[model samples]
Target: MSETNKDDRAALLAEAAGPATELPPGWLEVVSMDMDAQGVARKSDGKVVFIDGALPTEWVSANTHRKKNNWEAASLMAIHRESAQRVRPGCPHFGLHSGACGGCKMQHLHVGAQVAVKQRVLEDNLWHLGKVKAETILRPIEGPAWGYRYRARLSVRYVPKKGEVLVGFHERKSRYIADMQTCKILPPHVDAMLMPLRALIGGLQARDTCPQIELACGDTVTALVLRHLEPLSEGDLARLRAFAAEHGVQWWLQPKGPDTVHLLDADGAEQLAYGLPDFGITMPFKPTDFTQVNSHINRVLVTRALRLLDAGKAERVIDWFCGLGNFTLPIATQAREVLGIEGSEALVARSRENYEKNQAQRPVQQALAATSFVARNLFEMTPEMLVADGVADKWLVDPPREGAFALSKALADLHQARLGAEGAPPLPAGAAHWVPPQRIVYVSCNPATLARDAGLLVHQAGYRCVAAGVVNMFPHTAHVESMAVFERA
Candidate 1:
C-alpha cells in the first residue's frame, strides 16, 4: 500500500509542477557592453553570455533565458558588485525587472559614461567594419539628459479585467503594454498626460479599438495622433476635443494607415514648428513626418556640420537628403548658392515651403534667390549625374540608415573618369567636367553604414577622414547618431 501509493503521488506532483526550471550556472563579472547596451560576460565553460540590466566591470548573477550556439541571452538576477558609473534610474519603469518599460536603455549608466560608450561603439565600427580611422575624433555633442524626446509612439491597450486602459510603451521583452504613469524621456507636459490619456481612452465606447498614440512635440505645440481601429462616436469626438482644449494639445486621428491621419480640430490647432535659434531658422513639419527627436542635439549637430563643411559666402554648396531644409536653409545663410536635394518630391516641396517661410520672416542675406530644392532619387545616383551637378566647394550629406553608398560610389567613379587613364583627351567644359567638393560633412544615424560610406570616401573617393564623433541624439537609449568631416586628398 505504501510503495505503490508513494510512487503514484510523486508522479502526480511532478506532472503538476510542469518542466523543472533550470537555474543559472554561476555569477560572472561583466567584461564589457555590447552594441545593444547589454553587458557581456563569459561563462566558465567559455560560452559568452549577454546580461540585460548589468553594467561593465560589475559582478552579477544571471539566468539564461535564451541559448544560442556562440552566446546566451540572460536576465540579471542580482548585482553583487556595482560599477561606479551606475546611478539611480530616472524612470521607475526602466530596468530588466518584471513589467519594466522598454522605452529607454542605459538609463542606469551615468550620462557621461553612456556618451563614452557610444563613442567607443562608433570608433569600433569604423575600425572593425570599414578598416578606416579618423585623424581626429571630434568632441561628442551632448544635450539635455531628460525630457529631450520630442517624438514618441506610445501604445494603448484596454484591459477589461483590470477595468483600466494602459497608455505607454510596451513591457520589456513582452508584447503587452507597460503600465507607465509618467515617462521621463518625454516632455514634461506630454508625460503628465499619460494617466489622463488612459482615462480618456477608458471612457471611449471604442476604447479597445484604439491601439496607439503618437506624440510629436514642436517649439510651441505638441501633437498627439490617436490610432482608432473603429469609427469614433460623436461622444468620443467630444471627449477628445475637451481633452485637447484642456491640455492645450493638438489631436490628430488616424483612421487606418499613417496617410489617413487628420487633425480633429484644424482651426484650433497651432502650427507645429521647431526653431534653430542659432541659424535664425524655423522648420514646420507634419506630425507623422520624420524629424529629429531631440531639438537641442539637432541644433548642435547642424552647427557642427556647418562648421566642418566650412562653406564661404562665395562658395557654392549642396545639401543631400535635406529634409525641411534643416541643414540646407542654414547652409544658405553662409554659401553662395546652396542646392537642397531630397529623394521625395513631397519633401523637396516642403523644403521649399520652409525656405520661403523663413525667408519671408527674416530675409536671407546671402544667396536667398539662389537657394533652391530639387527632387532626385539619391539612392540611384550615377557618375554622370554627379558630374552634371556642377562644382561645389563643400557638400553636406545626411542620408538615412541605408547610408549614401550610391552617392559615395558615384563620387569615386567620377574621380576616376576625370583622370582618363593618364593620357586621355581633355574632358568637355561645363557640367560634364568632373569636379568634386573640396570638403564634405556627413551626418549619419547608423555607425555601420556610416563606416561603409566612409571607407569609400577615404579609399575610393580620395577623401581623407578629417574628423568624426558621436552625437547623443537619443540619450538613455542605444541609438548612435554621428557626424564626420572629409576633405579631398
Candidate 2:
C-alpha cells in the first residue's frame, strides 16, 4: 500500500478506537477515598483517577488501565508515602499481589481506622443524601476482626493443566479462583479445612462438575453445601461422607438452584443453630438461609438495637422484615406482645417453628406466649394496611439493601392523613385510626437507601433522628451495616 494510504488507514483505526490518551507519568498523592473504598487522586490536568491499593494522603505511582473522558481507573504501582492509618494486611492473600484473593478490601487499614471511616461514610450519606443529622452518634459496634465470617460462597475450579483443584475465593479483578491454603476471615477450624477441602475435591470423581461451595456456620455445627453441575457418582457420595466425618461437618448437595439444596445425611443430620444467650433464645436455620456473617457483632447489634428501642413491659412492638425472628424473639422477652412480619411465607413459617422450638425448651414465660409471626408483602405496604394493624408502641425494622422506602412512605402518608384539613371533623365511627410508634429502630445494610428512608421519617413522618451508628459486621470489607433510632417529635 502507498504511504498516504497507510497513514489514512491508521487515522481511521484511531478514530474507531476512541481516545487513546497515554497515562500521565510520575506519582500522584491520593486525596480521599470514594464511596467504593478506592483511593481518589487527580492527574496533572485535573482529571480524576481512582487507584486500588492506595490510601488517602499517600503518594503513589499508578498506571491508567482504563481511561474515560473525565476519569481513569488505575492500579497502584508503587507507594512513596503511606498514611499513618496504613498497616500490614492481616491476610497474606490480600492486596493486588499475585494470587491475591478478592474476598477482602480494607485489610491493609487499621481496624480502628476502618470503623472510623465507616462512621464517616454513614454520616456523610445521612447529611448529603437525606439532609438529616443524628442528635447523637452511637459508638460503633465492633467484634473480633479475624475469624468472624460465619458464611461464605467459595468458588471451586478443577484445572487439569495445573494438576490441582483450587477451592477458595476468586482472584482480585479476575475470574480465576485463587489457590488459597487458608483464609483468615473464616473460623479457625473452617480455615484449617481449606487445603483438605481442595484435596477432597481433587479426589472426587465429579470434581470437574462441582462449581462452588457454600459455607454456613452455626454455634455448634458448620455446614458445607456443594454446588454440583452434574450428578455425583456413588463413589463421590461416599467420599463426601468420609470427608464430613473426618472434618466433623455436615454435608449438603445442591444440584440446581438454592431451593434444591438437601442434606446428604438427612436422618443423622445435626440441627444447625445459633444462640442469643443474652435473650435466652436459640435460632435453628438451614444452610441456605439468610443470616448475619458475624455472630459476635450480630449479638452486640441486637443488644444495642433493643437498648435504643427501650420497649416497656406494657408496650406492643412490631418487627418488620423479621427473618427467622432474630430480633422478634429478643424483643418479645421485654415487650408485652411482639408481632413479627416478613415478606416470605416460608420465612414466616420458619420463624414460627423457631419460636415454638425455643418455647418448648424453656419455661412458659409471658413474653414467649405473646409472640406471633405473620407474612406480609412488606415492599407493597400502604398506609391503609398499616392502620388496619392497629397502633404499635415500638418498632424494629431490619430491611435489606433496598431499604424500607415503602414502609417509611406509608408512615409519612398516615401522618399526613391524620393531620387532614385544619377544620376537618372527626372520622366516622369504627374507622381505623392510625398512630405512629413512639420510637423506631432501623437496621440497614445500604447507606444510600437508608438515608432516603430517613429523610421521609424525619421530614414527613414527624420523627427525629435521635441517634445513629455503624455496625462493623464485615470488618475487612466495605459492607456497612448500621442502626438508627427515630423518635416521635
| Candidate 1: regions farther than 4 A off | 1-25, 44-46, 364-369, 418-432
Tens-digit lDDT track of model 1 for 88-165: 999999987789998888999999999999998798778756788999999999999999999999999999889999
Per-residue lDDT for 175 in model 2? Answer: 93
Give per-model TM-scores: 0.90, 0.91
lDDT of 2 by residue, 1-489 (tens): 233433332333333333323344688877666556677676655666778888888888998897765567789999888899999988888888887998988998888988988898798778867899999999999999999999999999999999999999999879999989889999999999999999999999899899999999999999999999999999999999999999999999999998899999899678999999889999999999889999999899888999899888899999999999999998988888999999989899999999988878887554373888889989998776787777899999999999999999888876765678354334333334556899999999988789999999998889999999999999888788899999999
lDDT of each: 0.85, 0.86
Q: Which residue pairs does candidate 2 place in steric collision?
A: none
**TM match of model 1 to true structure:** 0.90
Error of 1 at 206 (Å): 2.1
- Candidate 2 accuracy as lDDT: 0.86
- Residue pairs with colliding backbones in model 1 are none
In model 2, state the lDDT of residue 69. 58
